[model samples]
Target: MSSSANNAVSSPFQLFDRTEWKRLNGHFSYHLSQDEVDNLHALNEPLNIKEIEDIYFPLAHLINIFIERTKDAHAVVNGFLNKHTQRLPFIIGIAGSVAVGKSTTARVLQKVLSMLPGKPRVDLVTTDGFLYPNKVLNERNILNRKGFPESYDTKLLLNFLSAMKSGVEEIQVPVYSHLEYDILENHMQDVVRPDILIVEGINVLQVNSSKGNIVFVSDYFDYSIYVDADEKDIMDWYVSRFESLRATSFQNPESYFHRYAGMDPQESLAMATNIWNEINRPNLQENILPTRYRADLILEKGSHHFVKQIKVRKI
Candidate 1:
């Protein structure tokens, strides 16, 4: 693409270096305890209190502003219609490639928002739970494509979101077990009404491509964030995380990856690389990364998993 074309493409967002982004943080300084920060940090994603103060605090504040604005708008609409509308949860969707540290971001956001003045009741659910059971994937001969968009029950996910937005007091959602590498059979968790609900996953931003429909899971989101990093950085993170999991989760006798726990380091590295090149990389390129443009904000990470830039979508 020409330089002008590239510039036009990038026009939708105003990029901020970490320093500039930090300036927007304002004087409101509330810090998370060490324990809270540790609990929210993901494996292989080293998160410190300083990082949260620098990146997440400002983000949480911005989201609260949007939430308040949404409430005001809803009230105006209700007044115009001369009817009281049921209040719905403010939904935030966090999307990114696997190993991009999106999970940590979701958890931290939930914790931070819950502490805000209104003390919103925040809950998080991952799209991983909506993935088809291993048995179903095996039957379809797509077990190897587990993290791909096609592996998810998109219709079921849509129904869940619809229920949430419809002001349903409670809904049962399936649970996924990472250790078992499958959806738990006959197991569901109840989600009660929440002031804020965060849905996090790689495919949360994916657009439906079949039947000429352009609808996306993100369409229901009041706000969306995409965690981004260079391909090489993500590849390294994925490999390192895989190795860490092999030593921990994979060590469980019932774990689906138990066999890999005893593999030689060289072999394990090779397997991780192969999986990245074959599964994760292709999915990121064709599905996940394309959706980044649709997000309200982008958290761009640099070396050592530190977020180096923030891209806020321009109105």
Candidate 2:
């Protein structure tokens, strides 16, 4: 390709620094108390009101714009058809490496979006629930690769998404337990006609090429965000979160990782590092990271876990 042609091939995303991104929250009047922000925070991720005001407030505003426009388009289509049709829920997908604070982002966004005018009902679901049960994973010999794309029941997930878009009044989603590290038997969460649904997970953006799947999980997303950070920083955050869980959740006798609870700090650190290197790191590099550019927006985090830059895909 010629140099001029290469130069003409612009990036799909329009980069915005923190200051510029913060300024995009035009006429946004909703506010979340510090206590609410604190409750939404995930372990090892520092979330404060200022961070919400700067990063997620603007993001919520942008998402509201998309939601409103989608509703308008639906009305227009119905008008053109001279018939009334139910509007499907707006599904937002949040994808990123493990310990990249994507869960916290999803929770915060759900809260912010719920507080928007008319008080829309926003529901959050994680792809972890769509993962094959531990028994199934063990039978398939992929128990150790739980977060990889192959670990999920893609057909079932796709069906669920399809149902949601078809305006199914009530949909039952299986629940996954972190403490048990397995799908809770017979337990389900009912999603009852939410105006908006946020699906968050490490594997949400992944495409199952090996399975030769034509439809992808991300195809259901009306908008998507990928939380991104330096690999070194993510590793450090993962280790830190592991250490925290060792002292808390892992100590529960019912916890799947209860064995790690008794380990000393140094031993816990070493174990966490080994798991990251052997499993999570490879999954991130091979599957998750490659899908980053597929998102409509990317939030890049600094070492302190604060979002330092935002990239919005050009319309």
Candidate 3:
């Protein structure tokens, strides 16, 4: 290839300012309503239609391109094998530090991507469901390490992914209740085959080894995103989200964190800070942050939890 042609290909980790990224959205239409945006926004996190147009609209367009590319690749492989094969769900993994607004990002992506033409089916599932039951965690004496990768049942998560990718018509996933802060063993969330699957979690990009064997949750992912932000900003968001939850979900009588709801604001703030410093900060530094470079795209957030820059991994 000539030098000019070679230069046309972007190197990995190529960065784009918001304006530059927004230009890519010209090919797609934005069709989200205020009510839809409101339903998707996380408590204490700010996401507006402008943010969607600037960030996610282009992202959905990019993913749509990838989906089409995947179909072409699948057809080629099927032709080479002289057989017909079904197109499985395209898995998109979203990873980020706690309280960095990844859940909101996932919901926004699911909503926007579903609205795109082709009538694609999209489903969002968090890795929280794969967390070990509290009884098991307590038995293992790691209740305090709940969000750590070790707290998850990786084998089960892998099986679920495998089933979903194998075109299984119905797969039952464990249901986790944030209000109760535990896995509802008796309850199951059904994944009726979707065209797109968004798996959002802190450790979605993690490499796991069991019984001297290696497996990565991201191995099944066709596309991946990591939400990035300054650690201090994330800590602030964490404490703020904790406070908001105290006023909301924690107020429920059955909430595991219900005790926090009655605490004085000062006490609650201190406790939230302590949790951030002791649990989440360490997990982010040790595990989550290290995997950011692995994402196909990264949305770096700024003040008030707004995405300020976008990074697209080059082909």
Candidate 4:
């Protein structure tokens, strides 16, 4: 192909900011201190300077821009309505299929963005909190399939977010138990006016206009990311993560998944795959994965669990 001809066609795997993007050679000149880098490294994962520089730094940089725009918009609205200026949280939505590392992305963002100047109060909340109690799902006969849109109290979720974005001072979120796989009674997590709020879930971006609210929840997200990979790769990841958990977290008798600890490797693989195929995959294909284009950015991962491309939706 001629050099000029090559310019006419583009690779589908281009990251959102492929132009003028510079991948750090070995070490990135981050604001984090050496001690903090040590702590991040101790998270017992394989994240490195390259991933931070390429994937996350650009994201945080863009988020800063969005936050500034939000402040300007709020100022304009206040000026017109003759209302007092209130700080609004910049809402971010992280979405993906099961075991696609959206949780990992959220955790890393929570840590990195918190240290950024003028954004000391970053808070991360999972939509898992809005899930109905196990008893409710059991009664509704959807207990076998818990991650569906019907399993969550969408109305309450909306109220919490609306209050937070409307400049509410303090809001309480219900606490959930991974061990029990249910909402914990008499338990809640209270969040004040955080500078940034990252909400992660399988279907946080799904639309439900038929509900009494009749509002698109994702409209509140100033920016969003959809993690992507082939279906087969995600299944492999789910099984591998389950194996790791069974050998560790699930080993404790008090862990709700401890029952799976007794199963041998083969049996455990079968169980994990069954859960993904029966429950998680259906939810992904139906409600979650279809909304990828709705996201402001997409993190496309290869089979190796590393992001191969970052597609930032054009403005």
Candidate 5:
């Protein structure tokens, strides 16, 4: 609390501008085709080869270093214990507010990491699947709080992560459908002994201690990223994405939001704004934003949705 003490305080992260970070790309020769990059982009988010080359390639390189070092450390520890064991999958958690482009970052990393020297088996999973079913939420009277931490089946998700880290050969994860805006009862995603697993979600970095739970969702992550931007920018992006989806996916009769398809642009904008202010904004401010500093890496984005700065947490 003194002046000297205050002066001693410093950021835990080493910040890098776009040019500085791109220079760290080093000798890594990996490149994704423009078409492949195009497919990795999320709706209302722009991802081009330049972004991939400048931001993601260097990131992929850094992760590769972590992977190799982790394997080495495992071998050293096993030797010290005089026991042999398989290396567990390297898990990365990507956390951010809705419309902040975390999903696109996860997908891009999964692609780039898979292309690393040995073509490691990389799988990406979203925590959306871990969300409680719509019926459950409706019964609990928290259907509007769908993305909040309590809306997730935390125990099940913890067990899944536990099994995966314990070297389980296969695990079946429940699948959630955005079109239906609910968990699909019959569908499941099989994650079978991947070398690397990327978990992406708004709630991934949250620490919910109210349930008397000691272990957190992020505890299993070997590396974590927080996709960050100003709150106003994120809200704008959310509104834009909602309008785009209303024009496309919401037109499907079976889509949960199909009723929004007939709304005029102004109506759609108002509805999206209301939802953002009422639900997403509160969740972001209270839950998600507080966890940003916990990430090992932070991607700070500009209003145009391009990453303008990178922050690497000091070792």
Candidate 6:
């Protein structure tokens, strides 16, 4: 380990384990116990230390730092411009392929970040709440493609984020049902603008302004994160999730997905695989994954569902 050798360039694709985690390049981050990580990981199972050390710790810490710095910047800018220095919550976008564990990442960040110095009030809003009602999805012939960006009320979603980040005292975000698989009309969750806002989904970071549509959700994001993993691994994880849901979640008599419960294991497997191949996979390869490069940071996951390489955009 000579000085020059130690300083040699390393690929941004390097895999990391728990022991190798301390070396990740981030402005800030903190450690979590295996139990804590596991508790968070349960909601997003099949994840490992490599994922925690390499992907999450470094990421949460970097965000924690940015939130503080951005607040400072806002105060200075406001003072110079003779405007109110009051600031809205910092926004972080977490995007990834379905079943790639973005939910877990969001949850873990929320938990770990809560314990940070500021005890910053952290409010997480999942893009699922902005999705159009199931009836609209059926009419559009994209029920199978519900996770796509087009399935959402883009204008409303953008406006909501804009309001949240505009120093508004309180805002109402729509409520979505995992059972009904639809936005429950008129059911809104009111959140007072907190110190931090984490927006997560397959496409929270989507931005476009054309065809007379000027909605750009990510425009309000102070920082963004894209969770990364190999396609094959994601597919396997998705199918496994389906199996688990079938035994538990889908088995609830009143579950919206109850139809999937009694199916044979092989049938369920095919259903899951087909959905992944036909819908989720293409969305990942075409739309979702392409945005990885646009993120402030990218957390690449190894086959074992561990964070390997973390690519931070240069300042």
Best by lDDT: 5
At residue 58, candidate 6 shows an lDDT of 63
lDDT agreement with native, every candidate: 0.91, 0.93, 0.90, 0.79, 0.94, 0.79
Write down the TM-score of every candidate.
0.96, 0.97, 0.94, 0.87, 0.97, 0.86
On residues 1-315, what C-alpha lDDT tens digit does candidate 2 reach at each position?
988667546778888998999998997766677788889999989998889889888998999999999999999999999989999999999999999999999999999899898899999999999999999999999999999888998898999999999889898999999999999998999999999999999988888878888989899999999999999999999999999999999999999999999999999999999999999999999999999999999999999999999989989
Candidate 5's TM-score: 0.97
Clashing residue pairs, candidate 1?
A: none
For residues 23-69, what per-residue lDDT tens digits would candidate 5 score against the true structure? 99886667677889889999999999999889999999998899999
* Model 3 CA lDDT for position 86: 89
Q: What does the lDDT read for residue 170 in candidate 2?
A: 93
Residue 195's C-alpha lDDT in candidate 3? 90
Sort order, lDDT high to low:
5, 2, 1, 3, 4, 6
All candidates in order of TM-score, best leading:
5, 2, 1, 3, 4, 6
In model 1, the Cα lDDT at residue 179 comes to 87
Q: For model 6, what is the alpha-carbon lDDT of residue 213?
A: 58
* Residue 197 CA displacement from its true place in model 4, Å: 0.9
The lDDT of model 5 is 0.94
Q: How many residue pairs clash in each candidate?
A: 0, 0, 0, 1, 0, 5
Which prediction has more favorable TM-score, 3 or 5? 5
lDDT minimum window of 10 residues, candidate 4? 19-28
- Tens digits of per-residue lDDT for model 1, 158-235: 889989999898999989998899999999977899999999999998885863655568878999999999999999
